[model samples]
Structures are given as C-alpha cells and as structure tokens.
Target: MTSPSGAPGPGGPDPRRPSLAWLLLPGLGLLVLAAISVSLGAGDFSFSGLLAGTASESWTLLVASRVPRTLALLLAGMSLAVAGLIMQMLVRNRYVEPSTAGTTESATLGILCLMLLAPDTPVIGKMLAATAFAMAGTLLFLGILRRVPLRSPFLVPLIGLVLGGVVHAVTTFFAYRHDMLQSLYAWTTGDFSGVLRGRYELLWIGFGLACAAYLAADRYTVAGMGQQFTTNLGLNHRRLTLMGLLIVSAIASVVVVTAGNIPFLGLIVPNAVSLVLGDNMRRSVPWVALLGGSFVLACDVLGRLVHPPYEIPIGTVVGIVGSALFLLLILRRKGANA
Candidate 1:
C-alpha cells in the first residue's frame, strides 16, 4: 500500500510523489538562497575583502546581522507553513491558515494589550500572551464552524477571514486610542531589516513546535479524515484537535513577536505541497518546510533589491504574490469540481 518513498501506492507508482532526485533541486536552491541572503543586505559585504583580510567590519556585519536575519526568515517560514498544514488537516479545509483564522490578529491584539497593561513585560511574556490569545481566537473560529449548518470548503476560509477582520479591527482601534498605531504596524508587518542577534532567537521555539508537528503527523492525517472516522480509529479527535491548535497558536505568536506576520506563507505553501505530495504529513513536512523557507527567502531578497539602499516589507511582497496564487488555486479547484 506504500511505496519505498513512503507515498501511498496501490497500482504501481504515484507520479505526484517526488523521488530523491527531484528534491535535490529545491534543496540546493534553498542553500544558494541562504548564502545569498547572508551575503546581500544594506551594508556592504564583500567576501573578496574578507578573504583578503581587509574587511573586518564586513565580517562583523555578517556575524551580527545577516546570519540572524536569514535564520529568522527560515524559522518563520518553516513554522508558519507547518502550522498552516496542521490547520488545514484539523479543519478539513485547504484554505485555512493562521492569518485567516483569527490567530495572527489575536496574537497582535495580545501584544497590543501587553504594551498597554505591562510595558515592561519581557519577550517571553509577550510570546505567552500572544499564544494564549491566538488559541482562544482559533477555538472561537472552530466553534463558529461547528454551529454553521453548511460547511462548504470555500465558506470555511471566508468565515475565518471575517473573524480575523473583526479581531484586527478591535486591535487597530485600541492601538489608535493609545497612540501606538505606528508601533502596532511595525509588529504586524513582516520585515527582516530590524532583525539582530538577540531579537530573533525566539523563533527557535517555533522551529521546535514545527518539529513537534512532524512527530504527530500520523494522528493529524487520521484526524483529517473527520471526527467520527478518527474516533473509530481509536484516537481522541478533540484532543488531537486541541494539540494541533496549541502548536499552531504558539508558532503564530512566536513569528508575530519576532518577525511579524508573513501573511499567506502558511496558506499557500501547504496547499501547493499537498497538490504534489498528497496529505501524508510525514512525507510532506520536509517539502513544505523547504518550499516555505525558499519562498520567504526569495521574497526577502527581492524586498532588499527592489530599491536602492531602501527596502520593501516582505509582507507586501508575499501578500501580492500570495493573493494571486490563492485566486489561481480557487479557480483550479472550481474547474476540477466542474
């Protein structure tokens, strides 16, 4: 029932399942992009100068800023993509992700609340608050879905978007009242320009959560089959659902607190990967993480180069690209069903 590559195969081979040779290209691409990410920035960094023992400052800059920013990009991208996959499986909808499902908005709201209530809170405290709020918001979204009589796949993400919009409006209103709208914008928009050594280390926590998701991949795959089916298989559907929410919320909070929201990184990557690899989470996790990191790195590199010594936000770049891809996916699905 399964191929040597770990993909399901009843007849002979699943063409959608990629072989090791096919993976090499993207794996190499990720490495190249990471090298470029470390080498390219606002600051002048010349490898030739470093090799000649003349660019001490360039070396310092590489160590202090470039590496950390690149790491943050990879971590944020991987975490969000995996989180999105988990969400889609748990909700049984391809379109759902943290940004749409009120998770990111709730995390942003939590950060805003922290700034107001305890300005002196540490980074860990902010992460905790955001995670808690994100969990509650995701739960609310699920509760709403349960109450709805019709559960069209298209309707699910739309409901999530509406819920996210409401939470975002509340966050915006509070931020405006406190005269902290600018700060709020900085926290909500994805930008790597400000990332430094100490600031981005929290993203490692997200990386850990992503790994945990991999560990629970089988449970999630069964859960995706629906509650009654999962129950019949001797798994606790509600418990698995809660665990998935916890992982998703925690990853979203960490990314928001560290690199800000990279919208649609989660929504698009998992969907694209699922198209090729099917819903076997264990088989798909590495591909999802690699593609996610590569996409964000490409966006970030373009953001740096689009202007002269200035930068565009990664969020803007990803939003433009992601929206187009999202529309294409919807159209493609409609055609298939038609």
Candidate 2:
C-alpha cells in the first residue's frame, strides 16, 4: 500500500506519514541545537560582543573552533545516520549499522595498517585504505549472512557484533604491538575538541556521500524489498548493492578518519525515523539526517556542560545514551511480540 512516490495510497494522507509541516519540527530542532553547539565551549564567547564589534578574539575563536566543531558534528551525524539507514536497507535488518557490521573497525584497522606500513601517507591515502577495508569487511559480513541458516533479525546483528569483535581484536593487537594503542584510542574515540577550520574539511566528503544516498533513495527502497523483487522490477540488484556498499564504506571511513567513531548513531537514528515514517527511504532520509544531527549535537553539548572545563568524549556520551535506547528498543519489540 505505497504510492509510486512512496507515500500512503488510497487512504487520504496517512496520519503516520508526517506532513511537510511536521517535518519542519526536527529541522527546526536541529537548527536550535546547532545554535547551542556553536555557543557552548570551554572558551568564553559573547554574541553581543561579536555583534557590537567588540569581541575580536571571540570571533577568531568562533571561526577557528566552535564553528568547525559544530559543522563536524552535523556532518558526522548526518553521514553516519544515512550510512546506517542504507546498511539496514541493504541487509534488510533494522539492527545492523556500520559499527555493528565491522565497517568502522575495519576502517580503523586499515588506518592502523597505513600507520605501520607508511606513516607518511597523506590523509586522503588513509581514507582510501579505510574505505577499501570497510568495503571488504562489509562484503564478508554479507557473505557470512548468506551462508548462515539462521535468518532471525536479532541474529544478523549478533553475527555482525562477532565480526566486529574479531576485527577490533586484530586492530588492537597490532596497535598494542607497535605502541600505537594510545593513538588508536584517540582516533577511535569520538571527540570534537580538536576540530578546527582546516582540520575538518575532509568531513565535507562524507556529507556529500550522504547527499548522494538521498539521491538514490528510490533505488535503495526497491533493493530493500529483497533481491528477487528488485530483479523482477528490472533493477540490477548486485550493482545497486555495490553502489550502496561504496557509499556506506566511504561515509564510515571519512567520518572515522575525521571525527572518530560515534557508536550506535547510525543504528538508532534510522530506527527512530522508521518508527515514524515507515520504511520509505525517500520520506525518511531527511528526517533521519535531521534527527541524527540534532542527536549528536545534543550529546556533544551535554558532554561539554557536564564536567565544565573537562569534557567527556562524544563517543562515550553517545555510547551510554545509545546503548540504553538500544535496550529499550529490544524490550519494546519483545513486549509487542509477547
């Protein structure tokens, strides 16, 4: 019962399908969160001073730090959320995301390998290696899923967790041997404190990939209906799947390279959007992106304010919040089934 446009059919506008007006709510919320993110930081900033042409230092700090950090948050959040949505659609599992599927771990492993083999490799080179590894890891995960007899939705993510654990262990072992454990930890821990004007430009690539995902939303929605269905509709499932893998891998790699991993972000944001908008990718992508940005910004702001000058890493804050919500989603699913 979906229209060609991916909306409800036959029945006048479905209440579950958000009107354009309702869609603006999350957009507005993201804007407000962006404002707060720009305003809050360790450094003293005054809007009035800046407007009145008095706070020269404040303007410098705003441009060099706060603005960049906020932009990074938004880009990383939107990219990860879209990446997760695409992963879930391709895998036909609500529980799977880049983190759970070993994509991030594989990317980190690639970066570690680059550090060992050629420490002088530029940032772009590192990103390429990470993307390559992520794609291979994700394809391996899909291969495993095909071979496994179990098709339970929960089992899919559990398998991914197992794969991610193995990849992470490998990455950790190499990092520990080379005394790069601390460096690895820093790269994997999501934080925005270090973001500055020139440092965060790479994240724009990730944002672009996210935009690309939105453009291919209809194809992904078809692919999500299953390979047989997609083929019957005259679409090449394998090509679409490969394109999605590339998008997911590049987005994950770029975000990890730029801002470290924000776990469960891709997982929860899409699920939240799905609950409201159904599985229609076209309708849900914008909401997912907006909510994702707002969620990360809010978490980052909370981390900054919680300990004053000492800020908690965004990864830690998101892990705590996301894990709790993950459990709640599980419980609610079980309760509904019961």
Query: What are the RMSD figures for all models against the true structure?
Result: 3.8, 3.5
The TM-score of predicted model 1 comes to 0.95
TM-score of each: 0.95, 0.95
Q: Name the weakest run of 10 consecutive residues (lDDT summed) in model 1.
A: 1-10
- Model 2: CA > 4 A from native: 1-15
lDDT of 1 by residue, 111-155 (tens): 999999999999999999999999999999999988986435678
Query: Candidate 2 has which clashing residue pairs, if any?
Result: none
